[model samples]
Target: MMKKSFATLTSVLLGSVVVLSACGSGDSSTGTPAPGGTPSGGASGEKVTVTLAGWTSSADEKELLQQTLNEFEKKNPNIKVNYEVIADQYMDVMKTRLIGGNGPDVFYLDAFEAPGLIQTGVVEPLDGYVTADFDTADFEQPLLAAFQTGGKTYGFPKDFSTLAMFYNKKDFKEAGITNPPKTWEELQDAAKKLTKSENGKVVRYGFGAAPEIARQMYMMKAFGGQVSDDKGSATFASPEALKGLQLVTDMHNVEKTSGEPKEVGAGWTGEMFGQGKASIVFEGNWAIPFLQTNYKDLEYGTAELPTVNGKKGTMAFPVAYVMNKDSKQKDASWKLLSYLTGKEGMKTWTSKGFALPTRKSVAAELGYDKDPLRAAIVAGASYATPWVDKATLPTIMNNFNNQFIEAYSGKAKLEDAMKKAQDTANKEISAAK
Candidate 1:
C-alpha cells in the first residue's frame, strides 16, 4: 500500500462514540485528561483521553498493549489511552482521517510510508522532546536514521524485521544435505541437488521467489547494488543493481531450481516453505510466530541469508511510532511513545515473537543476543538498508516491480528489464517532483 496520511473523518466518528460511551458510563477511570491539564484521577479535574490507532489486531498484541497502557496509567494516573484498531488497508483509512483533521494522536508508521507522510507535513518531529537520556544511541543506526529529515528525527522505532533464510529441515534431510549453505556457491549447489522431480513433474522446488519490491530490495543489496543514488534518485540501471536483478532471474531461468509464485500457484514464499513445496526461502522474522502457530508440525530452521559473492547483507524494514503534527497532547504523546518503544515495553512486545526490537539494549535484555534466529536478524541490522527512497519511491517501486517480473519469468533479459525500470522510475520520480 502507498503510504499517505489518513483522513481523520472515520477517527472523528469513532472518537465520538468512544467519548459518548465514556460519558454515559460515568466511569472517570476510562479516560485521562489531555496533557498539561489537571490530573484526572481525582474528583476535581476532568478526564483526558488519547486515541491510538494501528494495523495490528492480534489478540496477544492487543492484550500486551493494554497491559502496558494499564501500567502507564498507574504511573501517571492522569493519562488514559483509548486504543483503536485500523482494519486492513490502513493507509487508505488513515489518509482519510488525517486529511479530515481527526486522525489519531499516535499511530504506527512503516519506513516505506514514513517518507511520504513526512513529505505531507502531517507527522510531528520528536527531536525537541528527545533528551540525551532517551538513549537515541541505543537504537540500530539504520533504523534510527530512517525517521530523520533535514538532520532532525521525527519518530521512534518500535520494532524491526530483517530477512533470513528459512529452510525446511525435512526437505534438506531427504536431499542428503547435512547442513545449510554458508555461501552463494554452496547455496546454488544445494538448490540444484534438492530439487525433486517425479515422472517429468517437479515434486518440490529448491527455492521460491516472490517478486515483490521488498524482496528485491534485499536481493539488490546482496550484490552491493544501490537501488537509489545518494541523492535518492533511481539508479537500478547501474551495473551493480543489474547484477542483483540478474541473480534472481538466473535462479529461475538459468538454474531452473527456483520457481516463481505464479508457477507454484502459491501466494508467497512463506506459504510455499510451510507447505514443504520449497526447500529454502527468504522471509522476515514475523514468519516465526506464523509457522509456530499454523504449521505446528513443520520442521524448519532459520539462518542468515546466504552471502552474495561472499558478502553478507539484508534489508531492514522498521516501523516507528509517529505522532500527528497537530496533536494537542504533545507531551502526553511523547511519554507514551517513549514508554511503548522503551526497553520495558519493547521486551513485552517482542517477546510475543512476531518481530524483532530495534533497540539494542532491549534485544540483549530479551536474550535475543544469544537466540540464533534473533541473532541472525540482529546481526543483519548493521548492513541492512532502508526500504524507502526519497518521497517519490513508492510510485517508482510500483512501476519497477511490474516490469521486473517479466525478467524473473524469463520473458526479458535482466539488463533490459532493469534499464527499462530505471528509465521508467526516473520519469515517475521527475514527474512526481
Candidate 2:
C-alpha cells in the first residue's frame, strides 16, 4: 500500500513533465538555486523530484542502477528520482549542460575530472548536507578522500575498482612457469618465455598495456617523478618521471614483447587475453565478469601488480555521486545521494559483484575480502593511488598520450617525446588561463 501511494504521488507531481520512460531525459527546471543549495520543501505537502544523469553503460549495468534507484524511492516516499543515461562523450555533454544550466540535479563524477569540475563552481559541496546517520567514516579513507579539499566534501565515492595482474594459467603452464611474477625483473623474464612466434611472425604478445596516463600514472612515481606540481601545472618531464615511464615503454619498443588493444585487434586487454592473444594484462574486477561472460572456458588467475622498484603500487579508479550547484531540489538531491552511497544502498548495488563497495563495513559484510577473484583488488585499496590529480589532468594527459604513443612505438626518443609532450601541455595550460 505504501509503495503504491509513493508511485501515485510521483506520477501526480511529474504529470506535466512527461516521464515516458523510467530513466529518460526531460526538459524541466525549477529556477536558479542559491550557491549553498536550496532547501527541500516549497509547499506544505508537495513531492519533490530529483533529476540524475550518468554515462550509458551495459544493459545489465544500467538495470542494476535502476534497481538501486527504485530502492531509494521505496525508502523515501516523498522524493522521486528522474534518471537519464548520456550517450557517447559523456563528460563533454555533461559539462555543456552544466554550463547552460540544463544539467540534472545530480550526476556521476569521475575522480580524474573532479578537481577541474569542482573549480568551475558548478558542483555543490556535500559537507553541509551530510547527516549523522550517513556514517561517512565507514567508507574507505583513500577512496572517500579523493573528492575532498580544504576540509570540504564535494562528492562521495559510490564504488571503486583497483588494478590487478591477470595472467592466463594455460600460458603459464605451457611456459613451465609455476607462479606469476612478483617483481619487475621476474615479470620481464617471464614475458620472454611466454612470448610465442611462428615463422618469424609474433603470434602472441607476452603482455598487453594500455599506455595511457590513467594506467601509467604510478609509473611516474615509481622512479621519483611527479606528474604535476601542487598548482596543477604539467611537470611530468622530470628525469625521474621519464625514467619510470621508459622502463615500461621499453618493453614495447626495445624488446617488442608488449602491445596495446589496437595492435592485436582487441577492444581492450581483457579481450586480448580472453582471445588468447596475450598471456598477461593488468585489469580490474570489471574484467572478471567480462571474461566470464565471453570466454567461460578460459582459465586465469589474479595477483597483486608486480612490485615496481621494490615497492608495491597500483592505481585505483573510483567514481563519486555529486550534486549540481544550480538544482533547486538540493535538499532532496542530498537525500538521494546519501541513500545511494550510504551503507544499505551500496550493499544492494554491489551485491552482484559488478562493482566493489566503497564502504569498509559493506565490503566486510559482502566478504569480497575472502573471494579469490576479488581479494587482490580489495587488498589494493590500502595503498592504491586514486585515479585523480590537479585540475589540469585532462589537458595534460591528452598531450602526453599523443606523443607518448609515438615514443612507445619507437618513432620518437623517450626523452624527446617527454620534452615535447611537457612543452605542449604547459603551453596549452597557459593559453587556457
List ranges where model 2 is wrong by over 4 Å. 1-37, 42-44
Q: For candidate 2, which ten residues in a row score worst on lDDT?
A: 1-10
Q: Each candidate: how many clashes?
A: 17, 0
- Candidate 1, poorest ten consecutive residues by summed lDDT: 1-10
Q: List the candidate 1 regions with Cα displacement exceeding 4 Å.
A: 1-47, 222-224, 230-232
Task: Give TM per candidate.
Answer: 0.87, 0.89
Question: 1-433 in candidate 1: lDDT tens per residue?
Answer: 1110112212321222212111111233323453434222323444456667775535666677777778777876666777776655667767767776777778888787888889788787888777777888899999988899888787988887777788998989988999889887788899998888889877678987766566777667666677787666787767877777787788788888988655766656677777777899877776676677769999988888888876777777888998877565656677778888888777777776666789998888888867866677777877777776677677667777878888888888878887888888888777766
* Predicted structure 2: lDDT: 0.80
Evaluate model 2: give its TM-score: 0.89
| Model 1, CA-based lDDT | 0.73
